[model samples]
Every structure is written in C-alpha cells, then in structure tokens.
Target: MKSRAYSAHTLSALVLLASLIPLASCRTAPPARPDTAPSVAIDGSTMYCTISWGKRGAYTLSGQAEQLDGSSYSVTLERLDWFNNWQDGWTEASVPLEGKLLLSEAGGSWTASKIEKPVPARTSAAQIRHRNTILEGNQAADLFDRRLERVRATAAWLASESSFSPADGNQFFARAGKVLFPEQNGYPEGTGQSAVNAEFKAGEGMKWNRTYTEQSIPEHLREVRDSGTLWRDWEESRELFYIAYTWEK
Candidate 1:
C-alpha cells in the first residue's frame, strides 16, 4: 500500500508538470454560460459548446470571439464529428450545430462541451502553426486557405460515413457557409467573425475507418494545398470558428 501510494503521488506530480509545459498541451476549458442570462451582443463571435466530464455529465460553455478588425470572430466549445461532417461556421450563443435551439432561446447558464474531430496530420493545428506566415495582407488569406482545406477534408470524411454521400461535398461547403459557419453568412461578409468545423474527414472506404487515413496515393486536394499564397475567392467569404454543443444541464 505504501509503495502504491508513493507511485500515485509521483504520477500526479508528473501530470501537473506536463500540463505546465507547452508540449504537454491539454484540451482547453470551454467557456461558461451566464447564470443571470445577461444580454450578450449578437453582433458576431460569441458561441458555446459542451465539455463533458463523463458520459453526458457536463456543462455548457459560452464565450465571445476575439480577432482583428473588419474580419469576423466567434467562440465555442468542443463538438463531435459523429458522421465525419465538418462546418466552417460560427455560433453566437452556443456551439454551432443543426436542429438546435439558439443561444438566446436557451437562455441562462447551460452545460458546456467541445467537438473533437480528427484532422489530417498534415493539416493539423500543430502543422498550420508552423507554416510560413511571413506576408501581411495575405496572412489572413493563407490561414483561410488552411482552414478551408481542413474543412473540405473533414466534410469529405463525414460524407463517407454519413448518408451525406460524395456529391454532397460541394453542397456541404456551400450550405456550410450558412448552416455550419453561420456568422460568416450572418454578416455581410467581413465585419468581424469566427467559425469552427468539428468534423472528421471520413476516410474513403467501403466502411468508415474510425482511424485517420492519408492521401490515397500521391494526389492532393487541388486549390487548397498549393504550398503557396491562397485567397478567399468565394463570391463573399468570412471567418468563423466551428464550435457549439448541446447542454441539458
């Protein structure tokens, strides 16, 4: 018993030390919902999601988006790419989702959570963080390109597992601007926005591979991973984080 006790103590101490190190990063704490239900500005940004401690035992997270001028902003908690679908969108009051109550509608404090979807190793957060960001004006555009790439990959992943089908890729991207990435579509496009797309890229297979896959061979996603400058050329485009969650608490 004494030996086990010492080992446990040492383990706890190691865990704490690891958390303090950037390399030992942990999941972010989702925002908290307001208890008094104050009037939160609906201009842009501001979203929420659920952070479960265990199975269905969690609270809702609510927060606002912070970003540069003229661009969009958003905030949200974790979510799931249940069907491998992704959305490059934003949520003002809660995490972004479909067939859900608006943050304003829910009112008051709620449970928080997050949606963790598998991203391609090449396009993962760590990878993008290391990418060249030398340009000024094109910095935002470059990030957008990275984001769109991830979005497309995740959506394609989702489509494979879900009834979504292949033909839905472009459709998903088109409607995603409105459904998944709502704030971008919410505003006129570029008045401060943030969006999130928490969907796994459904690997191409007869059955959905719960594991991450790579480019089938040598081909790559055209237009997204050009290894050069990328511009947001959508007829009208905006930035937003994909975050939101269901909170029954």
Candidate 2:
C-alpha cells in the first residue's frame, strides 16, 4: 500500500515523574479481608474504585508522598478516575484492561490508568479510515520514543538538583508539556503497532532546557477550592502541574 502523507503536528506526550523520596507511598482501597487491598495507597493519599463514574469500582488506587525530610508532601494518581471527571452514573469510565500494572519507583507511584489505550476521540468512519491511512507506516513511533527519552532525561536532571536548582517546578512542567506534546513531530499515532513514528528524530532536535524552584501551586489550589462550582473538579490550570495525553496520532 502506498504510504499516505500525514500532517506534521505534535499532540502526544510521555511523562516521567519523579517518585517522591519519602518514607513510603500508596494506600489501596479497603480490602475485602485484612490482606486484600481494594484501593491504591501512597504515603497519605488513597485512590479507590475503578476509573468508573462516581462509584468506586472493583479497583481503587491512590498514592501519597511525604517529603523524606519534611511534613508537607504531594499526592498524585494515575488511575482511571484520575481524570477527576468521575461522576455518578459515569459509564464506560474505563477501557477493558487486561490488567493493571502498579508502577512504583524512587520518583513516586503511577498506575497505567487505561493501560496503553487511547482516550477515544470522536471520529467518523471516514475519519477513522483517513487516520488509518495517513497515520500508518509513518515514523511516528521513533519521534514518540525520542520525545519520551528527552522527557526522562529532563526530569531526571531536574530531580537531581537541590534548592535554587537548575530547573524550577514550573519550568519542569513546561518541559513536560513540550515532551508530551512536542511542537516538532505532531502527535503519536499508536502506543504501538509499528515503529512508523520512529523514523523522524533519531539523535535529537531540541535539547530540553531546564530551571528549578519555580511554582504557582498556592494560587492554583486556592482557585480550585474556591471556584464554588467545580471546586473538587477544578484540578487543572496550574496546581495540577501534572497532566497526561494519549494519541492514535
């Protein structure tokens, strides 16, 4: 089949978060028995239930991080409900997962959320057909992986530094944003199927720049707690300094 030309725009991103350097992390949902853990548990945070609507489904996972040297810590989750859009009667809340992999490291903790699944997009049969064609046999995988490596290196570099560090929090976020959604190669088409995406950037293009200690978390969280409406839902904008994006290209 003749390869169709695809638009060159970046949309997908890979995030390599630093596992909180804490005494411990994670809090799984209450188990049926003492030995069973229905939720995911981190230092102090907990995520319960499947990524379904407001209801805590069979699998609940959450994590908490207590700074090894301090009392104040941060908690983050990468479960189905992490979207924070969890609502009552929210159906089709998750993709049928073969199984979930609990990933924990010195950096912190993270769950697959959807496990290599693309957050479904609204596309017509015609659109799907078009995507199937143009997005195929392209070097998108290479670009995606390359992007991930860059993010990993960038994150690692940032995490290694001390106070007044070389990379600021906001700066790290900006780098992350770019890594997840590079302006160069456009979005990745598949998690996987082929290495079509890998043909573009082999060595490197933009050496990610880094800076440290910068943040706008306070103002962000305050706005969320006071939004009066989507307060709990008001998780984006800044304090959320965290995000994930998937692509089918």
Candidate 3:
C-alpha cells in the first residue's frame, strides 16, 4: 500500500509542474510595442491623423489660441480641387495643442498649436510707416486720376456738340475745376493742381477752336488718355480755351 501511494504522489507532482510551464512561458515573453509614428492625410474636408509625441507637420489654422495657458485651438484642412489645382473645400477641428513643433514630419496636413515662446514681429515701426505712406500715396493718385478722367469726359462731350457756346463751356469748367485742383479741395501738399494749366500755357497761341487735333494736346495727357488722344485732346484743349477766356469775365 505504501509503495502504491508514493507512485501516485509523484505523478500528481509531475502534472502540476506541466501546468505551470505555459504560465511561466507567458510571463517571460516580451510585450508587443505600440505603433507610434506621426502621419496625416486629407480627404475633402475630413483630416485623418496619426501623430506621435513631440512632432508636427504643415497645417492651416484659424481662430485664436490662449497664450496664458495651454489650451485647445482650431484648425482647417482644405481639399484641393485636383491633385495640382486649387483647394475647393475644407475641414475643421478643435484640438488641445501645446508647445512648439520641433520639426515637420510630413506634408499636406495642417497643425494648430500654441508655442511656449511667442513669435517675434516680422515688421518694424519704420517699415509699417513706409508701407502706410505708399498705400496713402497710391490712393491719392487714384482719386486724382479718376477726377481728371471725369473732367476730360465732360470736355469731350461739350466739344462733340455742334454749337458749343463759350458760356456753357465756362460753366462746366467752373464746376469741374475743384476736381482738377485737388490741393484746393483739401488734398495734402504736393497734391496740387494738375498739369493742365502748364500744358495749356505751353500750347499758347495754338488754335483754340473745336477743330483741335491729336497732334495739338500735350504729349503727357495724350499718352495716358484711354480713347486715343485725337478727339480727347481736341475737346480738352477747346475747354482750356474757354477756361482762359472766361477767367477775367
């Protein structure tokens, strides 16, 4: 009976050892690592992304981000009309983005995030002043040109009339004079009267009739007049004559 019991006990111990082997193997095997690399793609207005820690890519952003604390920001991804054409649509999303991107890992994606350090201003005070001055000058010149065009058009119409009276021409010139002399109408210094007077004086003693031709007007105005200088100069010069004749009347 004792010998039989010892054999049974040893068999039971072997069975228990076999059962623990699979468990031991499981514990010793290494854990599978997660797939963690940054990637992004766009389809229409939807943006798909697989961004890993500490990386960034190109993106279009809108709205403001809170600088005081790391907060969520909004971004947009535009879908191109064709592979080589312009964007036709866009997608938007709000995400908690913080810290400056160290490097760009991919293209065709938009990322919106806050940086720890604010970006330095690209334009200086002097540069802003210079740019503003140029814009203002351009605006002033455009206004002057438009006003001069209206005057020229009116003069041309008057000249086309078969019986243009000097009295009517003088009346028209008086009304349009303010536009020709912008300085008198509150324009700044240097935005003085047009070169019309100078041109008229240069062409002094020239025929002051409705028969003025393209060859008669000043070259400067002739060059820029839209409707060829022939009729324009004829009308304009005739009006100038009326202006001079009626000045002392």
Task: Tell me each candidate's TM-score.
Answer: 0.23, 0.22, 0.17
Better of 1 and 3 by TM-score: 1
lDDT of 2 by residue, 1-249 (tens): 111121122000001001111112221221111112222222223222121111222222233232322222233333322111122211111111122333322333222332332222211111001111322112422322332333233334334334212133355445443333232323223322222333222123232111110121123222222222122121121212222211110
Q: RMSD in angstroms, all models?
A: 18.5, 21.5, 33.0
The candidate 3 region of ten consecutive residues with least summed lDDT is 77-86
Query: Cα lDDT for residue 191, model 3?
Result: 31
Q: lDDT tens digits, residues 151-243, model 1?
A: 454344434433333232244345444432232344223322322322232222212111111221113433232221112323212211222
Q: Would you list the C-alpha lDDT of every candidate in the order shown?
A: 0.27, 0.24, 0.26
113 Cα displacement, candidate 2 (Å): 13
Of 1 and 2, which scores higher on lDDT?
Answer: 1
- Cα shift from native, residue 61, model 3 (Å): 55
User: After superposition, which runs of candidate 1 have C-alpha atoms over 4 Å from their true positions?
Assistant: 1-39, 43-101, 110-135, 163-249
User: Against the hidden true structure, what lDDT does model 2 obtain?
Assistant: 0.24
List candidate 3 segments past 4 Å from native.
Answer: 1-135, 167-249
TM-score of 1: 0.23
